[model samples]
Target: MDKNEFLTVDEIIELTGFKKQSCQCEALTANGFSYAKDAEGRPKLTWTHVNAVLNGQINVVAYENERPNFGAI
Candidate 1:
């Protein structure tokens, strides 16, 4: 990834299909996600963080129906 490319809280929300309270913002609050400040001191997340959450490393699945769509793997 390029240094200019980074994920925002909103983008991570869309990619992970998680509610703001349950994802990035919460991660930031709980210190579960990786992030840094922008020039304005706003939080910034990375694709790596999104992927980790999506892959269940952080175990954010709140509902059984929302578990990963894994097939026969």
Candidate 2:
């Protein structure tokens, strides 16, 4: 997979409109994005998740425990 597959810290900052990492993570979490944190504690969001959310392939709140359909992409 490409390294650019994940949203960078700057992109996450811009997306959530938050300068603080904690706040950004919280905002993403509130929006139902399942993310992992890097060694520096920065949130890591995959393009797949973003695409799934944007394409309405899955419900943010309801699909918390469900795996997104990777084949659809």
Candidate 3:
């Protein structure tokens, strides 16, 4: 857990408990996203991607609140 190191996909998944294909990882590699993969393919997602995903900047649709039906109102 040093500043020079990062977690792998499984680690991130375990830390965040985010399901597979969630934006926690996808947000890392996304264009214009806070972080990207290093040459070794490890993401700085812990700092950048996790927050964005939590804040709805990425992978938002999956966590949406269910729309309420008003009975044709």
What lDDT does the true structure give each of the candidates? 0.60, 0.84, 0.53
Give the better candidate number (1 or 3) by lDDT. Answer: 1
**Best candidate (score: TM-score):** 2
Model 1 regions more than 4 Å off: 3-5, 12-27, 58-73
lDDT (10s digit) by residue, model 1, range 1-73: 7765787556756644565444545556454455676675556777777577667776643533465668947
Backbone clash pairs for candidate 2 read none
Evaluate residue 23 in candidate 2 and report its C-alpha lDDT on the 0 to 100 scale. Answer: 97
After superposing candidate 3, which stretches have Cα over 4 Å from the reference? 1-10, 13-34, 57-73
lDDT of 3 by residue, 1-73 (tens): 5563555667666654565544555643333334555775454555555557667776544433343457768
Greater TM-score among 1 and 3 belongs to: 1
Worst 10 residues of 3 by lDDT: 27-36
Poorest 10 consecutive residues of model 2 by lDDT?
A: 60-69
lDDT for 6 in candidate 1 is 81
